[model samples]
Target: MKLLLWLLLFVLCWPLALLALLLWPLLWLLSLPFRLIGISVEAVFALLRALLLLPARLLGHRGS
Candidate 1:
């Protein structure tokens, strides 16, 4: 789908399309730190949830 849009843009304006192609990797690299931080935060929340639920799990409780 994105490829089709880029192809259309390439037809309409070659320069911008080429520029986007060139800059895409740079944009991805710039976003990596943010993605990593989001993953780390999610893991922390998951760990907290498991810790909070540990006592119930140890007591053999069933969840619905």
Candidate 2:
């Protein structure tokens, strides 16, 4: 009787545990694209600032 109870508990909980394990990585993978987009946008802004400064400097701007 005790063995049967243990087996039943294990069976019930196993699926939930497995689902958590599978979904964790899947959720991380799904968010990866958003993370990459954020990084790229920051890079683009940095490049734009550098390019804009070059022209301002050429035009004899003291600070910009």
Top model number, TM-score: 1
Candidate 1 ranges beyond 4 A from true positions: 1-11
Q: What TM-scores do the predictions have?
A: 0.75, 0.49
* Tens-digit lDDT track of model 2 for 1-64: 9999999999999999999998999999999999999999999999999898988889988874
RMSD to the native, candidate 2?
A: 6.8
Clashes of each: 0, 0
Query: Compared with the true structure, what per-residue lDDT tens digits does model 1 show for residues 1-64?
Result: 9999998877989888789999999999999999999999999999999999999999998766
Worst 10 residues of 1 by lDDT: 9-18
- Which residue pairs clash in candidate 2? none
Q: Write down the lDDT that model 1 would get.
A: 0.94
